[model samples]
Target: MHLSIFKWSYIVTAVSLVVAFLYGGPSALFLCVILGILEISLSFDNAVINATILQRMSDFWQKIFLTVGIVIAVFGMRLVLPLVIVWLAAGLNPIAAFDLAMNPPADGAAYFPDGRASYETLLTDAHPIIAAFGGMFLLMLFLSWVFEEREHTWLSALERPLAKAGKLDAMAVLVSMIVLLVVSETLAEDAETVLFSGVVGIVLYLAVNGLGTLFEAGQEDDETTADTAVDKALAGANGTDTTDNPTADPSAVQSKARSGGPTQLVRATGKAGFFLFLYLEVLDASFSFDGVIGAFAITSDPIIIALGLGLIGAMFVRSLTVFLVRKGTLAEYVYLEHGAHWAIGALAAILMVSIGVHVNEIITGLLGVAFIGAAFLSSVRRNKALRARGEDPATVGAASH
Candidate 1:
């Protein structure tokens, strides 16, 4: 609805057209446009998840996400990541990999002089590892969220059981590991690669998430200490026992926390924000694995892939993120975040299974859209039901003033 949110996307599309035209020709430009659209289609859910996280972040960090983060998303993940993958997989130096990307062999021809393998071929061959890693990482993210104990749930029947199961520490990680093992055994070849990559994904999630939790806990402890000291000082000045004052109103305390308390409670700052940024970048990379690989199907030209999918796609995704945050879409929809995570879970499963069996990209995109759409409709129904019951939808679960 906000045309301004899409302003950058429009500018990026125009720039991509010119660049694509100059780089190759009309055909190249057309491919660029198509790839850009594909990226957007494939990544809408990603934008939603990003908004869920971005809403928690401070405005300063949010700006950084849109600006510096866009650079990393577009150039770092889209361009450099592919090069790194090819370089590592093919044992080619970075320069050679870049050259191969720029000048890939004819459709079926091998690029290596010794007839070893083409860059595209090698990249394709690495799919199992890529899929396993990305799948596991995404799966872990979704599981952690779904299993978290919450007062309200979109899918109460299912989520309630999951929340109960979540009482066991590291339940999400344990389940993810079991799934990874099962998936690894199904791979015909490079099972080790799949297993190892999956382990790396799990470890990466634990490490990043653990760091965040540690810092958050530390911040909370510090705040509690400060608040306690202030309370004692006030009690001394008033010549009254601290306990004599009735306990502060819980709702008021919560309101204070929400408004004046450390915004760091939800969005990290300082060292924590840095790591949160890293986590986001890694998550984006995982989401992009399919898009990067799928781009090869559209065109073997890596430059075109980067221009359309990388640059243009990144812009639109960022725009969508800002739109969601500004409009308070997540809070309004209520179940939308739940649906996004469920979609993420499904995507993760599909990615892992695709290691042994190919899955259509269209199916992947549709699955996400379906989950999100269903959740949106469910939210609308819930809102109407609440209104019918003489309750304001906006006040649902909100702390009273």
Candidate 2:
């Protein structure tokens, strides 16, 4: 609710709009505005999920996310990534890829661009692979959320059943692989490529998630050790017998406090933060894949896509994340997280479906909005019910299941 949180977003939106206008004139400016709105609508749920992670990160890292992370989202994913996909897929070097991107063939005149496919053509050709990878990764995120047991439930009938089903070992992985196999066999033309890409997606998700968990465990251990060291230092300073053994090295305990107390804890936290940041980046990339591809439908201009989706849209999402964290939006709207994950599940399904059939960007945006909107309303009702029963809504469980 604080307007200050969105101060930069407003400034960036205005600057990006002016740049859009200067770059491509009135029509381009209009399209840029439209694209920005489209990106926001498609990515509102993304902000919610982002806030869940951002809240746990230190303020320093949060600032890095807004600054350095935005640059990667803007350039790395939206601009350079498309080019890289084309380069790798077509076996073209950087120069050739950039040249091809700059000079896309005219619509419907897809003979070939100088004995090679056009930029848009190649990117479209790469959709199945993108869908396979992004879809499976997002599906894993969704399944893990849905299958986990929780005290709170948005749709108890559906969630309760899923939670019970989750007791089976590796239920999420098994279901994801089965879905990947089904899609690859039935939907994809090149089943081998789709299957391979999907498997890679699943593996990458597990690796990143596992690394994050490992780092988090290390961080906890470091904090515990530092706390013990600090306590011993305090006891020694107070002339208390902290240890049972009279021969214990008091100097050693003091050295640990002086050397490893705050410094070692900070290092462990930073390492954990780095991996969590990496996880957020990957999640953002997976979410943006469909948007990046869908942007071509509006305009074939990469600069415009970056201006709208990156500068305007992505900046807004980051600001919204800050707002959610500061305002404790998720804690208030308990079902909101469930809604975002459901939206993600829907998106994963749409991505897999688009491997064979084209889905309009409008449909993709609407489905996300619908789920989130419904969840918000449901959350409001729950709050009212709790108030009527004389229970403090804020005290209820809001775990990130």
Candidate 3:
């Protein structure tokens, strides 16, 4: 390992262990590290998107993001969230699950009977809901990618028809929910439970987005005027051709196009960062459900759950976000964001599916990883092709050579 790597690893490990010890003991500490690695691997794509946004925030907001954000992720999502779903779905009391997670011995004996996290009992009971949620998320992801082809003229034409009927978005959400309720309810009752939880999450996402957009302060930039008189004078000496009208300057087209689009894209993407952050977090949660449930396939200790999974795994995602930004991968890899968006859409569908069927977490995760991996590899190949041909890498952005 690099010397810097060793130092950061040691520090993070030491800090995590200390936190684990305060919560439970050595078992929790060990589990925290294991879960941390698992979460980081499953979530690197999330980090890339987060990095893209976080890099733009002021340091004060960045600090808030790392500190307060982690607490919300840990206590709010990891620790309490699963239990809340149990209450909302199975009619189990909220505090009952929390008390069970806290009172390890009591919950282990009475609720689980098999000596596991009571939350897992809730989830296993609600498998259909999880399957539906995951399935829907995966489906959404696939559709997003399918429609993203820039050169596909047919799709652009199809968009109008699809939009007119609201056939895509409404149909997707409605069909998935209907299937989860009608079919999964008959086959697996707990699946309905998971579906309810996912719907709640989607509602939350819509609300957050609405609020963010409402708060947005719009601004306009003054358009740049080209020095056409100076351009005409210089071009006259160089025997450059222009349109008969002096202002119809063909010579300046390249520079004007280059300047205009980038400024607009940067501004649009900057505004987009917050919404993207919300999407990424929601997407990460969808992916985490499988891992969280699967961990019960291993052990059920809440301390181990928090330490092994929460501290080590979830915490590291934050660090990974930092590393992605610091390394400047977004600037280097043009398609990384596209890959992430597609993966997110996939994960969302899979999450919806998990509510209704027994979609394996490993398969769901690999599907997302595969999508992103393909995009990244494609970006690399395109970059290498340009390099080999002695063309500027910047041409990747141009519509034509």
Pairs that collide in candidate 1 are none
Q: Candidate 3: TM-score?
A: 0.67
Which residue runs of candidate 1 sit more than 4 Å off their true CA positions? Answer: 1-4, 107-116, 226-266, 397-401
| Cα TM-score per model | 0.88, 0.88, 0.67
Estimate the TM-score for candidate 2.
Answer: 0.88
lDDT (10s digit) by residue, model 2, range 1-401: 66789999999999999999999999999999988998988899999999988877778789889999999999999999988988888898867887877777776444465676778888889999999999999999999889999888887878989999999989999999999999999999999999999999899899887887788888787777668667766685557855633454667767766776554524324877787788889899999999998988888788899999999999999999899999999999989998999999999999999999999978989999999999998888888887888887888653222
For model 3, the superposed segments whose C-alpha errors exceed 4 Å read: 1-10, 18-27, 55-59, 90-95, 102-117, 127-202, 210-281, 398-401
Could you tell me how far off, in angstroms, the CA of residue 199 lies in candidate 1 after the best superposition?
0.3
Please report, as a residue range, the 10-residue window in candidate 2 with the lowest summed lDDT. 260-269
Better of 1 and 2 by lDDT: 2
- In Å, residue 258's CA in model 2 sits off its true spot by 21
lDDT of 3 by residue, 134-170 (tens): 5455444334344444421122345334444454554
Better of 2 and 3 by TM-score: 2
